[model samples]
Target: MPPLLTGSLYDAYGSYALVPAPLPVVAATALVLTATGVRRAVSHRAPAVAPH
Candidate 1:
């Protein structure tokens, strides 16, 4: 019974610890995607070559 309780507690703590790990990755991906989209939009609107 003691071992079972310990395992359950360990599993709970491990799960809680893992919960916050992906947040930064998700935020960074969103930022990169947004920046890429904005850059593409701006590029498409501007002329390809500048005239003197």
Candidate 2:
């Protein structure tokens, strides 16, 4: 059961709808991966200047 759905809400779903239950997990994983990749690329774009 996904955290967003309560017991009552989850219970309302029929067997057919259960097939797509993993969609949310897949979407969340993709979002996390994209954010991490973007953050890494941006952070490494410039180097710190060395002191004389």
- Model 2, range 1-52, lDDT digits (tens) per residue? 5555545455677434564667789899999999999999999989879999
User: How would you encode candidate 1's per-residue C-alpha lDDT over 1-52 as one tens digit per residue?
Assistant: 2455546755878644555555788789989999999999998896779688
Question: How much is the lDDT of residue 25 in candidate 1?
Answer: 80
Backbone clashes in model 2 = 0
After superposition, which runs of candidate 1 have C-alpha atoms over 4 Å from their true positions? 1-14, 46-52
Backbone clash pairs for candidate 1 read none
TM-score per model over all chains = 0.53, 0.52
Q: Report the Cα lDDT for candidate 2.
A: 0.74
**lDDT of each structure?**
0.72, 0.74
Candidate 2 lowest-lDDT run of ten: 1-10
